[model samples]
Target: MPRLFLLAAVLAATTAIAAPDNPPVPLPKPPQADRTPAAGPPVPAEKPKEKQAPAAPEPEKEKETAAPAEPPPPPPPPVETEDRAAFEACTAELKSLGAAFRTLPRIDDGNGCGIDKPVAMTRLSAEVAIEPEVTARCETLLQLAHMTRDLIEPAARLGLPDMGRLKAVHQASGYVCRKRNGAETGKISEHARGNAVDISALEFEKGPVPMKIAASEAPDLAAAFQRTLNAAACLYFTTVLSPGSDDAHRDHMHLDVMKRTGGYRYCR
Candidate 1:
């Protein structure tokens, strides 16, 4: 008990204790360095954005100028039924029939007179050669060839057996840019468009027979042969103006591919 009393008296006399209301004083601030910049005056409140008039619409920017619309594209060219290629389906027929021919450059004489795909035909088959060669569209020459092989030659063999195998065909005109019947102008002739052929005579190994021969003067068999040949031509051609049809075509057979409805044909 005496020791405990002595320890309590020692703790009460220590100087670490202080009165409850008293506190220590703060220390002074240190001196600033010489190189330190003094604080600047308060920035003048930013002047409230200096209210000014709105900028003039940026000068309307030239309205970005409409960029001139490109001129409308040109129109497409007109299409025609005869515009098929030079040797389309007819090429196979030409080869099969043993024809000698070559494609020609386009013939455009303007004013609706032209052949888009022309051909120069020298012969139809071994049995028949086109004297002077025919310059017309492939379709036109093909028609003539088919007629020669299937009709004319066969007719000659049967009608004029004395004449050796029909050797050649003498053409009057193939492609001529003139009016019908050589008139000044009424309507353009099929020859002008490379769509017609004119056969003036038939040459055989024995001799030649002119187309303009009068029926009365011609031998009975020859007259009959001409009539049959002319009739058969209608089956292959759209127009057939055979000998004696008219004075204009008396010296030749004027055959053409004249388009018509329902496969119409005019065979005189």
Candidate 2:
């Protein structure tokens, strides 16, 4: 029995020693640290944009327009008078005598001497022309026309054969608004009243022939003719002033028909 027990214990010890070695069990891993989500792909670092300059403003355009037209000048003022009938009668008489004339309105010179029925004589008659025009009274113009046709033309023809006919009489002075003898303060002149005329030259078919009142300057024939003309003018005109009269009469013959208290005629 003892031998049998010893054999059994020996068999158990041998069985334990003959078994293979087993692997050790692994320990559980600590909970992993909280994971952070990865940021989306890194955005490329943005470069700073450059600042641009502002554009310049455009210039304003000018408008095209025409300027307004200017107004016209005013007309001349008319003369005032009340003697229309007398003026019309005088104008008609002048026309009837074949004298070319125009009636002028009254000229009030602010002084005493101003004609009421003045006539501007363009021609004495169809054959006779008044050069440089003459403004005179109706009575004076009529007398002048008669004298020119009768005495002046015939006398001129005798002297100058080439003077086919008397074309014009060059007048030095006519109706003038001035004092006597051109004095500033005095009685008004006959010229101012359109009652006087000054003859300076005579126009013929050829040309103009200036009257030389100085006897020394005139030719022998011309001197005699001038003397004759002066004498004839004295017969027609109440006042006749020639070269020998005064320095004022040295260049022209001044003639007028001024009535005197006595029938006294002044001729020089």
Candidate 3:
């Protein structure tokens, strides 16, 4: 019995000795939220693009326009019409009187001294010739003719018996373009308007008798005839300027039909 128990103990001890020596190691645990790593440098934000302004529009062209029209002119004066009629009538009368005359055009000096219609008288009547020809207005020529027929011839028969028949009238000046008394400036002379005559002499059938305004030193009959004619001229002429009037009229007799304001006669 003892031996058998001893054998059982020895078998249990051998079985223990036959087992492995090394043991297995255990795995690590997972990371928690509080134990995470820190964040890196932050990335820079991107910059926005700049906006641009719009351009201005071009100006429009101006429109074309038309201009206005001008007005008409005025008519002529009434006095001019009347003067024209009077001049025409005078020309007709001259034709009827058998006076040898020619119609001349208007004479204007552009200084307010002018004749509208003038006549160059060649003869006073059929028998009486105007020596050197007298250029004057129709009215002035008519007056000259009337004086020759009515007064001069009849008076010559009495005062100038030696040369009783009339032949021609010697005119020194007619239709002269000058101011009064040949002055440079003043009222226009009647001669400028063909309204005056400067009688220098009278040609008779026998001979020519030169007119001397201051005839105190001349022959008795000649002086008497000149004086008589000088006095008679005032009856027909509106103005009669003889030698004694002024130095300007020393040689010849100045006769005109210038109108006066009060039917006054200017005989000097």
Off by over 4 Å in 3: 1-82, 214-219
lDDT of 3 by residue, 188-260 (tens): 7888877799888889999888766655667687677778877889998999987566888877889998879
TM-score of each: 0.67, 0.63, 0.65
lDDT per residue for candidate 1 within 1-268, as digits (tens), equals 9999999888887645644566768886666686577679877666567779887776555556668897865532222335454468887789789999898777777656677777888989866899998899888889989999889888998888999888899998998777788897467788888889999989998999888644656668888898887788899999999887888877789899988999889988
Off by over 4 Å in 1: 1-86, 213-219
* Models, CA RMSD each: 21.4, 17.1, 18.5
Preferred candidate (lDDT higher): 1 or 3: 1
lDDT of 3: 0.80
What are the per-residue Cα lDDT tens digits for candidate 2 across 105-151?
77766555567777889898887788888988777777778778878
Error of 3 at 212 (Å): 1.1
Worst 10 residues of 3 by lDDT: 73-82
Predicted structure 2, TM vs. truth: 0.63
Worst 10 residues of 1 by lDDT: 74-83
Query: Candidate 2, which ten residues in sequence have the lowest lDDT sum?
Result: 73-82
C-alpha lDDT of candidate 2 relative to the true structure: 0.77
Clashing pairs in 2: none
